[model samples]
Target: MDVLITGANRGIGAGLVAGYRARGAAVIAAARSGGDVALDVTDAACVAAMARALAGRAIGLLVCNAGVYVDKGERLEDGFAPALWAETFAVNVTGVFLTVQALLPNLSLAEAPKIAIVSSQMGSNMRANGGSYAYRASKAAATNLGRNLAKDLAPRGIAVGIYHPGWVRTDMGGAGADIALEESVAGLMARFDALDMARTGEFLAWDGREFPF
Candidate 1:
């Protein structure tokens, strides 16, 4: 399979690139910097340029993994500034939309295209922990976007799946997080491999459990 992954320089993204390569997939590892394709997902022009550059390449899988968690530990009193919210949402929400929109043609070239959105369980209203408001809200929006995209793309033979990649030991997830990068990557690959029209619009955990929105 040919896969295009964003935010693929490090953390879960990097691990995913390695895992897919090991499995013999042709991987296009895109990043904001230091990758096969340097792309600022937040920039519409940049996204469009990348898409045009890769116009005919068939992308069987598109993983929208670029995201920011700028308000991780910020308190509502003084932290979680307006600028931070905007920055986080730009990357976490708008970035995903732009990437998918720009790559639609490439995706259409494949026999069965799939989109995996690395959203978070924290986005679920049932899982609210009352902190990291910006991250939570942005992820929630991403999940919603993925669901709607699934509906719209189904007739076109493109499936969309949203997932929480677990609390991994990445730069954003921290060392104290529950799972290792390998574990999350492995689970996510499984989920991606199993993705199809029947499972489109499903919000799932990396381990293959269905998640509540």
Candidate 2:
């Protein structure tokens, strides 16, 4: 199997890439700074270029995991500064949309094509507690984006889903979160492998439970 992961330098994205690589899957990792797949998700041209370069190669798993927070500790107005919100959404939302759209040609060849967008519980309106307005709004959009993509792409046999990795102890999640990055990533990847057409368009937790949209 072949896998493509975005924002794969540290934390969940990087760990997931490592896990998949350990399982012997050919991996293509993307990041703004650098990684195995040095493409930036924010750049449509870059994603398109990378996808074209891969051509007819099959990508069994496509993890649209790249995301950012202006700062987890501050209020969105300052933490996700007005200026930064644009870039953040460009990376966190539009990036995933464009990357997946661009990679469709390459993804079509996979025997079991699966697409996962890393979302957050902050995006959950049903259980919202407030704060991080920018991050929450952008992810809410991504969650729905995954749902729409799942429905549109199901006829082609590709399964698309969104997941909340919980408050994983990553740089963005900070050191205080209750869950470890390894635990969250492991559970999410396991769920990804077990998904099928019936589960498409769903919002699920890392531990394999479904969440209301």
Candidate 3:
């Protein structure tokens, strides 16, 4: 299977690249820098160029994993700047849409293409805590994008699933996070493998539990 993962230079994205490669899948690790393919998801031209580079290849899986948490510790009083919101949404939400749009043709060539969006539990309305407003809102938008794409692409034999990869110990998740990177990667791979038309548009966790919207 040909799998392409964005933001694959580090953290969960890097682990996913290794995991898929270990399974013998033809993995295209795409990142803004230092990856198999140079792609900045926020840049439409870059995304288009990447698509052109892989013109005739069938992509069995497209992982929209590129995202930012710029407002991680911003204060409610004076934090969450306008620029931060724009940057976060550009990468977390718009980036996903652009990548999917640019790669639709490649995905259609596959027998059963799947799109895995690495959203977050913090995006869930039911699980809304407090801080990281921009990150939370962007993730929610990403999940919504994935859900709508699932409905639109079902006829094309493409399944889309939104996932929360758990509180993994990565730069984004922090060292005090709940699970190790390997554990999260293993569970996420299983989730991606289990995705199909019947389960499309569902919000799920790394461990396979349903995540409330």
lDDT of 2 by residue, 54-144 (tens): 8888888899999988745676444667777797789889999998998887679988799999998888889787877778889899998
Taking the tens digit of each residue's C-alpha lDDT, what string does model 1 give over 23-129?
Answer: 89999999989778989999998998899889899999999999888897898888988899999999999999999999999999999999999999999999998
Off by over 4 Å in 2: 76-80
In model 1, how many backbone clashes occur? 0
Residue range 1-213, candidate 3, lDDT tens digits: 999999999999999999999999999999999899999999999999999999999999999999888997799999888999999999999999999999999999998899999999999999889999999999999999999999999988899999999999999889899999999999999999999999999999999999889
RMSD of 2: 1.6
For each candidate in turn, give its C-alpha RMSD to the true structure in angstroms.
0.6, 1.6, 0.6
lDDT of candidate 1 at residue 179, scale 0 to 100? 97
Model 3 stretches astray by more than 4 angstroms = none
> Where is the poorest 10-residue window by lDDT in model 3?
64-73
Model 1 CA deviation exceeding 4 Å by range: none
Count clashing residue pairs per candidate: 0, 0, 0
TM-score attained by model 2:
0.94
lDDT of each candidate versus the true structure = 0.94, 0.86, 0.95
Error of 1 at 79 (Å): 1.4
Better-scoring candidate (TM-score), 2 or 3: 3
